[model samples]
Target chain A: MLKMTFARKVIAAAACAAALIAPAQAEEKTYRLKLAETWPTNFGTFSEPAREMAKLAEEMSNGRLQITIDTANKHKSPLGVFDMVRAGQYDLGHSASYYWKGKVPNTLYFTTMPFGMTAVEQYGWFYYGGGMELMQKVYEPLGLISVPGGNTGVQMGGWFRKEINSVEDLQGLKMRIPGFAGEVLAKLGASPTNIPPGELYTSLERGTIDALEWIGPAMDLRMGFHKIAPYYYTGWHEPATELQFLINKRTMDKLPEDLQKILLTAMKVSAYDMTINSHHVSAENWVTMTDEYPNIQVKSFPPEVMGAIKQANDELLEEAAAADPLAKEILTSQADYLKQIRVWTDIADRAYLNSMAE
Target chain B: MLKMTFARKVIAAAACAAALIAPAQAEEKTYRLKLAETWPTNFGTFSEPAREMAKLAEEMSNGRLQITIDTANKHKSPLGVFDMVRAGQYDLGHSASYYWKGKVPNTLYFTTMPFGMTAVEQYGWFYYGGGMELMQKVYEPLGLISVPGGNTGVQMGGWFRKEINSVEDLQGLKMRIPGFAGEVLAKLGASPTNIPPGELYTSLERGTIDALEWIGPAMDLRMGFHKIAPYYYTGWHEPATELQFLINKRTMDKLPEDLQKILLTAMKVSAYDMTINSHHVSAENWVTMTDEYPNIQVKSFPPEVMGAIKQANDELLEEAAAADPLAKEILTSQADYLKQIRVWTDIADRAYLNSMAE
Candidate 1:
């Protein structure tokens, strides 16, 4: 009887140990996160970073971190990603920072500005310069963590029915441009208007708009704008248009240390990958566009017109800076960084390219 | 007595399950990897990718992955990284692909080629335009897996004691330039010689060589070459000098699926990060160089000189292609890719830069 009693006690002790360790192990439970992206389903490279991030995070965490992405089509709100993520409707969002400019005025600076740094130079500022801190200052107040999502190397100026020979050509020109760039065009006496994406083609085709600025060749080729526009102008505004990833601070804080690192690294790598992919797709599509439509003329606005556009951009920047102290600080930082970096760029890449041309 | 027996049976069953699970858990044992780098300790941006990759891999794997790095100083073989990694003396190596040209002539094409694509374009070629397949064809036969380690965006031609006015100026000019670029210069009647990095500065200072080609401002600033040399020439030799990460196929195959993904993601992200960081450092260092030494003149070789150099490079490439079927295949692919992509580059980035210059 005593032996039986001892066996019973031993079994109980073993049960207790199992109880202790099982839950500890179970603490490695799978975390399911919902991400919302601004781009609709199958929106080319714009939708890539979110999916790539989710896959990487899940793999790196051994299936512990599972992220499901909802495109704008499913969510029925293309521009609502910021609010959705902020209100806890989604844990994360992938969108352009400039998309939130209407809600948060300071958010505009995080994306490319008019005639801003190129992709490499802007990345330098974001990582090495004070761009990240400045970005954090703007986001932390809203309970958000923002990171570089992707970069469109250099956006094209626009597709034009008419070649812009001088500043006078822009006067009273009906163009479809949006956001701050549109505002800059407005300052130059051009009638810059925003149209729905679906309506853009019709507008350009029917002479409703004289010109339209869209994304570069990668995304634009599918839109079929190259079929209508004969003159493709080079970019001046929106030089390095960087998309952004936004995370709810609370959600990020809740993750385990390793999972958190996985998530962060995944986001970072996906962002960089998207940048490279964009360049690749653009090169591929550009070849296709030219091969099929051999008459598509590439043009850059003359120096006189470019100088006028620059002046307008500078004035608007000044006004924005004067209005807000943070804006001033951010603008000043970007300007100082650009001034210092451009010298090197001129000496290195620019000189090299020019030499090759010679 | 019946109740006690039932409880005992349950405990025994639980114990059996735990035993079954524990070995599966034990499979998550930590993996320690040693890596050898071609660069010495504290070798600036060149040493960053390996350390960054190791950190990311460990964090992502929840401490399952740990990597330690040894520089050339410790390994006593800067040029032996390839052999060491191949022999499993080190699990991994960080070096440039071109370093193995003498041993494996086919390894030369993985790094940047003269007059080839720029950084962004080359990355495009690697990921999307079939560069990766070509690289794998070379490395897989040797039981190695190689990935882009990092990039020095564009290397400046060299610092010169006198201006290179024409093709004639290169005649009898002794310069410290190695690899394929040296061969090109030698074809143009320049006496191109290889020297130890430690001895380069003294040689240039003491007139042992009239000029020397090193890395760009990011690395060159530390060497203080601008202090002695007056002319800083633009690059033609290496447009995008991509460093390489070599892994033993057996070592990689031994890793778990999730760990393998973590390792790959870590390497890829670290490589991209280094590219951005190099640009940042170069911009920072260039500022320092010019601020102190105001008289340092930036020049591009005359068109006549560049033309002669191009012809020599083309002939050497032709000979390389004639030597091996794989070499011919790679050269053709690169040429074809460059031809297609350069159009997009011209329309997008190059056009934008020129417009801004105007």
Candidate 2:
């Protein structure tokens, strides 16, 4: 394992020096890369990108760029993907960037913000709007290269047992939510609790937790949350929940340019593919959920309730921005971009959708 | 070109057979494929996917696959891409599927419909909802394999010199809108015209055309239509205009497995990349357009006007469906997929965006 770190990566390069050395093609070494995913086995679309990327990398490189992925069931530490990749134990990692927010404060901004841009909007920001640069600034110091892995469009606000009609309804509400969204709920006087996936259905089915926000209809349908919680609220907290792909800087430096390109392209293409798959599955599952359970109601918070939550979110973001320069920079960039792009989105997608609605 | 058609595609297959055949590695061949694009050179994001795909394919295969593209200006055949690729004059082509409607009647359904799905929804329809299979059914008999090239979100409803408040206002309106959209307008007593892009600004300026719909802000801003047309309307006609990559059946069959994988991955990834780039450019360009011309009024057709247009669109579609079984199948598939998916989209993205709006 130690020797293989620098032992592989003999790519079939151009026709110059290698052709001169021998009449026949030169011997090429196959580089095998190991990936660690934060999800367990059969984690649905959340688990698709890593598997698809690895398969594509291998096939494109003709077995030259072999990649094997180990899910969290094998790795045993869902949150330790960053450490394992950075320590060079694994060549790559598939995880959400927000998971590292406790360690790296700026990591929270890379994943979806409370009221940030949607998937495509954030994708534009990442590739064309200086997001990749800012992301590298946050990850480069950790000796890692982080890129977008996948997106879950817009997450459902949560499965609420009771309606949130006003600001006062949020007080002392107990829900199973995580990350900065939980903090926003905390600011609004809700008790945000983190529970394991295996325990969520049981917890929600019983009186242990009043509500829970998993992914969208895709994963949540299987959890049977709709059967227990009748009111499914629309999203506000995390509009575009994007996962991250992390690679060790040392591992990246060891590969030939062609192999490097192959790996990066595989990751990106798979990321987009997974996003489309996520949308497909969510749309399919939403229909299945609604059909199987006709009594389930989809609701949105009243404007006053939303306004209050937005205010709390704004204040929390302001305080975070004030405490750190990087936070302020990321927040400002996102805010300005959202303000500009949302107008076009409103005029383009929103208007079309509204005008066409029956 | 004839020598190179079957001359390349000698992939480094596997170790056992290849190593036994030759003591050293065997020499690989570089496959050069020629592509014809509908757009002329420097046609903005429309020209990006082919170039980016060619670059990625070459890099990933280490120059094993090389693709060269000829623009409409070079070939003097903007609408001849489908013919060129099918006739084996070109191995691949970059153009919209709707451009081939004059040649293949069913080709119109693959690009977009009058009032169809948005970018992501259309993408879902293509990848996950049997759109590719239906597309293949349309193109397979023509000796071509067509895949999505890129998308330009929601196309604006063109720049208008005069406001259209009622259905009566569309009487004899000379609008430079092409494709099935023009047919939809023609049903509404409007004189639909097709002007050369180079002469579009002059035509609108001199009253040769009263209004024109080219694309979104990205391409529109450079055309300077806003300087003359003060009423900028939101889209109703062509939603999610997806470009296409047309590969000759012989061309696809000739490539080695690895090279084929590389080429396909590059095409898919570049398609998604260009979609993101389109969104970025439109957002940036929208800001610039409004900033430079503050008098631009962004409006949507009143409900009555939209209803009339939609009625005309539906009538045309119903006639098309009644005429052909393949057309009915494709249209039914899209309508069903859109019906199911739009509910989730309304609840997820539309709800989220509306809640976030100030």
Go through the candidates in order and give each one's DockQ.
Answer: 0.42, 0.46
Q: How many residue pairs clash in each candidate?
A: 0, 1
DockQ of 1: 0.42
Q: Which tens-of-lDDT digit does each residue in A1-358 have in candidate 2?
A: 2132222223333322344444323334568899999998999999999999998888887777778899999989999999999999999999999999888999999989888899999999999988999999999999999999999999999999998898888899999998888889899899999998889988988879989899898778888898889999999988998999999999999987778999999999888988888888999999899889999999999999889888889999999999999999999998988888888889898888888885
Off by over 4 Å in 2: A1-26, B1-26
For model 2, what is the error of residue B195's alpha carbon versus the real structure, in angstroms, after optimal superposition? 1.4
Candidate 2 per-residue lDDT, tens place, B1-358, comes to: 2232223223333322344444323434568899999999899989999999999998887777879999998999988898899999999999999988887899999888878998899999999999999999999998999999999889999999999999999999999998899999999999999988889999999999899998999889889999999999999888898999999999999897888899999999999998888888999999899899999999998999899999999999999999999999999999999998899899999989888874
> What class would a CAPRI assessor give candidate 2's docking?
acceptable
TM-score of chain B of each: 0.94, 0.93
Each candidate structure's TM-score, on Cα atoms with residue i matched to residue i, is 0.94, 0.94
lDDT of 1 at B299: 90
lDDT of 1 by residue, B1-358 (tens): 2343344345544544664454222323578899999999999999999999999888777677889999999999999999999999999999999999999999999999889888888988998889999999999999999999989998999999999998999999999999999999999999999999999999999999999999999999999999999999988899999999999999999987778889988998899889888888988998899899999999999888898999999999999999899999999999999888877777777777777776
Docking class of 1: acceptable
